[model samples]
Target: MQSSSKKETIDCFENAIKNLNNVRTLYTENFVNWKGVTKDSKEYYTEIIAEELINKINNENIISENIKPLERENYKVPSRGKTFISNTNRKEENVAKRIDKMECGELGHILYYQMPLKPNNKIKKVGKIDLVSFKKDENIVYVIELKVANKNETLLRAILEIITYYQQLNQTNFINSFKDDLGDKYKKVEIQPAVLLTCDCRAYEEVEQLDERPYLKELIKKLDVELFSLSLNIQSIE
Candidate 1:
């Protein structure tokens, strides 16, 4: 929803976020009761809520020039390293950029550098997914992992992460933890796991080699993660 006034838009967004927090709290507290709530019911409720928020914001008619709805199916990834910044420790940010561009085209709404998958207050847990996108009301979002495609620590860790995200769909609590980041802008957002193996044939071969190792393959297969090999030439930095 577009708003004509910037002030109204910001206010509307803030109010929407507040409402979302309340709704999630209600859901969590009444999980057993709400368990019977069908997906369509949830979607309809959220859509109405979202529309109200948008109208509230638009009422002021002070539109922010920067606010724009994501376009669908014409996404492009920016030159890495330069345009996009990543935590030096992980390459997920860069990999996600590529996938978003590939899947959503330029019209994707990408949320990058998300808070660590495990919040600071929680018990020690592996970090967060690299990116999250709301692709203009599309059915799926790409949960990307960027790691070297060899028999290394990073690759193995990424595989685990992809599965974690996949399993997250079933964990209402864990998914709610992300509500702050996701906000209430999009409804029916579903994450699809993807691993962008950022390495050449040598490294790619290393992963393929794991095929013979039934255990490793089994673990990966369970997660239903995809593998995309990016050339080392795919500079993450500009």
Candidate 2:
């Protein structure tokens, strides 16, 4: 459904976020009834409503040119930090390290761990990406967002966040940072958006089920975002 006004568009996104907590369990059972309806009273399937909201938000989203790169010392592929910015997401750190270790022929040889994105001088920091993998041989760059097996975040939330992050990145500034710091190998990389889910997570399992849903397939086709599931060797991140 095309949003007739900007407020309607914002309403769609705000509504989805408000209902985000229910998506993992109640998505298939709910519907996005008209605006102002209580969350409990909405009456429609999630994919149908979410598909519209996602398309709306994604179509309107654009990469802000304000993103600036840090100094050469900060662009290190194998990050020095062992913990996330929050210092609590050990599982994410573990996954990033594991991906960083893989051969370039595999998931990507060079990885950027918890890379901080600076939106502008005023904000200083916008957000930190989970990981960015560069495969030199194929000249492909994967902008990845990682979620561990125990994470309970919903599939829709993953879709929304990865899309937002991928779009928010300043491609021109980011590419310049890579070329100036990492060398010519990154000059022609093909950037792709991705979401990495630990094999047993709710989002992973939920995504597998989404494969048969046309709305989801359509959504993926529209976004061009890839979904991957990794089976971690360790028993638990705990």
Candidate 3:
């Protein structure tokens, strides 16, 4: 049987994940330009919701005791049709900071960084990765792909998607692609590509299966891509 502390921890984490999802949904739904707002004045409401989640996490004493209140210190009301790119950046930075603060063998230790995925054409299939990293010294960045389950198939898809990104944004090809727009400066920016996977799902158990894929192995051989499955277990204090 699960201990009361364990159960409370699971519940707290579940609630946190739900709130995170809500934040992402609101951000995606109202996303427009760089401001991250909706024309219908929904940005204020979304900000309010995010504030509430943060407050609940910060002020609550016990997992199932007093009700949690919403806090607004950490978030801002976005402008209509504006994108949540800034928030995403904040999230990634926070993830990195959290990893930096941890001891060895801590959960959620991996950090992710910016990974852009643009298709050959205009139609976009997946969103751009915000950030991913595996210890600054490890020299591995995960191109995070969040999902619930069935990681074997998901990891395969992630591998292909990252390869496409590699083919588009690498040193040799990008310089020419941006030559007309960037002129001489295009060659000046030195950018190394890193690919990885990030999710809150318990799929790390299947990590070995992912490393064995033929196409995945080939892609890794050429591009140095990596795979990381993230799982967060937050305990609620009483």
Among all candidates shown, the one with the greatest lDDT:
2
Candidate 3 yields a Cα-based lDDT of: 0.35
Question: Which candidate tops TM-score?
Answer: 2
Query: Please, what are the lDDT tens digits per residue for candidate 1 over residues 152-220?
Result: 333334554555544433334433544555567334566667765655523355466664434444445
Stretches off by above 4 angstroms in model 2 are 1-45, 54-89, 104-106, 120-125, 180-182
Pull out the clashing pairs in model 2.
30-44, 31-44, 104-109
RMSD in order of candidates = 19.4, 8.0, 19.7
lDDT preference between candidates 1 and 3, better one: 1
lDDT (C-alpha) at residue 49 in model 2: 50
lDDT of each: 0.43, 0.57, 0.35
Q: Is candidate 1 or candidate 2 better by lDDT?
A: 2
TM-score of each: 0.43, 0.65, 0.33
What lDDT tens digits, residue by residue, belong to model 3 across residues 88-118?
A: 3244334433443243231223332333433
Please report the TM-score between candidate 2 and the true structure.
0.65
Report the lDDT of model 1 for residue 192.
69
TM-score for predicted model 1 compared with the true structure: 0.43
| Ordered list by TM-score, greatest first | 2, 1, 3
